[model samples]
Target: MRALVTGANGLLGSNLVRELITRGHEARAMVRRTSNVEGLAGLDTSMVYGDVRNIDELTRAAEGCDVIFHTAAVFSYWGYTREVMMETAKGGVTNALDAAKAAGSKRVVLTSSTAVFGGSDGPKVLDEHAALVEVGVPDYFASKAIQERVALEHAAKVGVELVVANPSLFVGSYDYRPSASLATITGYLGDPLKITYPGGVNIIHAGDVAIGHILLAERGEPNEHYVIAAENVTWREVHDTISELCGVPKPRIKVTRTPALAAASLMELAAKITRKAPLATRALAEQTGRYFWYSNAKIARLGFLPRSMRQTLTQTIAWLLVSPHLTNKQRAKLRPHDDVLQAMRQAQVAQRLKSVRIQDLS
Candidate 1:
């Protein structure tokens, strides 16, 4: 099968493209000309230059594809306005569907985030049937919710098969720029964290999420949603895990939501004054106040069992430790001692790389 992956340079897109190639599919990587392709190094991919917002370019790229893996989106809490994000988010989905519709693709696997489901109060496991929780929605979640609805509606009206894979906070290797979630990890590893919020994250391996996409395309019913995640862990748990793994001291200060929000407000104010993006925005603080937990039972029912989060963290830390992009200063900050990082690198070197799924479902 021939596949076209939008945002092919992104974390999930890069993983999906590798899976496609491993399955012996011809991968047409559709990315902006300026997007980094370092993650795609040595992969047998047919690179196409185009923006997801461009219907004509996307259509040209999507032509002659068996499936369209649409994973393109702008994921920033700052540095761009809601209007700009809305246009790109909404237009991206619509344009991808249009291209898939024009190309006569058999299926369209759209990678979405759990942000669309909003926040849960506590240990409740949310499924796709849960309606969008609108209270305290940040600009990023709003754009994503709108984008997903637009994509689903477009796919439905056009009679195209669309499978939505909603993955929670992913942690694994191949994070070139190290995604926002990974940034939180590395930032804390670089320096002992002084404070943290009170929320939870459903962490999943990126490779597992990529495989979940393939399972969705192969057997998932059209117009259905799959919650793809590994486990639900609290912020404290995450911090403790990192501390234990990297030999860093955990932050003793746990700020309540109100105080965190105040800190975020101050940060945002300082950011505006300094003309730089805030490390912790009000949106982030509010999000951290609630649990981003979900049930992966739906995808698991389709034989999608993910590796443990600790295993994922080991790989993630190892990748960051050895990354060519990591500066000497950054490495020193992250490595309070050499063994902390050296051990992870050695462990990763001992393990074999992940291979493609779907092709070898036996």
Candidate 2:
């Protein structure tokens, strides 16, 4: 199949492009001219420049593609106004569908986030049927919900095939922009004493999420939504895994919900006054102790197989250690001793052996 992936340089998009090539499909990567292409360095795929907001550019880039994977949007929570976020999310999808129709693309795999399923205060497991949590959702997540709604409605009106892939927090290598999940992981890795939040989230490998995207395109039912997720883990568990992998002491400081929200509100106010991004926002603070868990059985039925969280983090750290995207300070903070490196190597080997054994048994 011939495919066009918007935001091709992003964490998920880059991985999706690689997956397409691995499956012997043609991939036309559509990225902004200003986007850093370091992660896509060695891939053999056609490259085109375009913005999802501009219909003409999208139409031109999408020409002759069989499917269009719309994954372009600002993923950051701070530093962007609500108007900008909504427009990019909603308008971007509108333009992508228009372009896809113009380019004769038969299907469009819209990359939406599981944030649209809304967050849970306890250990509730959400599925594709879950409603959007309307109260106090951050603009970033709200925009994603809006983006999916608009894409589905608009696609129906335009007579285009649309399948929504709602992915949870994904971690893996080739994160050139170093997505929000990666940023959070690096922050924990950068400081052993950093405070931990109370909330939990579903985590998956970005590569696995990429494969899910392809499967959605090829086999997913039109107008249906699939939550592609793996393990559901708490923030403390996430921190503990990283600490073990990096040989750092687990964080002793735990920030409860009330204080976290207070700090986030103050940061939001300061960011508005200073026109700078805040370290925490009230939206994130609101989700402090909540659990964002989802069932991936829908996608799993289509043969979606994700690695364990430990294996994902182990590979992530191994890549981050030598990634060109890291600055000098980040490099220094993430640098592990010989013992930690050996531990990671041992873990990788053990995981490989276990996978082989499982396969042999099956």
At residue 122, give the lDDT of candidate 2: 85
Candidate 1 Cα outliers beyond 4 Å, as residue runs: 333-362
**Residue 282 lDDT, candidate 1, scale 0-100:** 88
TM-score of each: 0.90, 0.89
Candidate 2 on 1-362: residue-level lDDT in tens?
Answer: 99989998899998899899999998888887788877676677778876788899889888889999998889988878899998999999999899999999999999999999887888889999998654468888899998888999999999999999999998877787777778667767655467897878898889999999999999999999999999999989988888777667787899998998898889889988999777778878878898999999999999988988887777777766656556777666554656447645753443343211001100
Tell me how many clashing residue pairs each candidate has: 0, 0
lDDT winner = 2
Worst 10 residues of 1 by lDDT: 353-362
| Model 2: lDDT of residue 314 | 75
Per-residue error for 138 in candidate 1, Å, reads 0.9
RMSD of 2: 7.1
Give me the displacement of residue 321 in model 1, in angstroms. 0.8
In model 2, which range of ten residues has the least summed lDDT? 353-362
Q: What is the TM-score of candidate 2?
A: 0.89
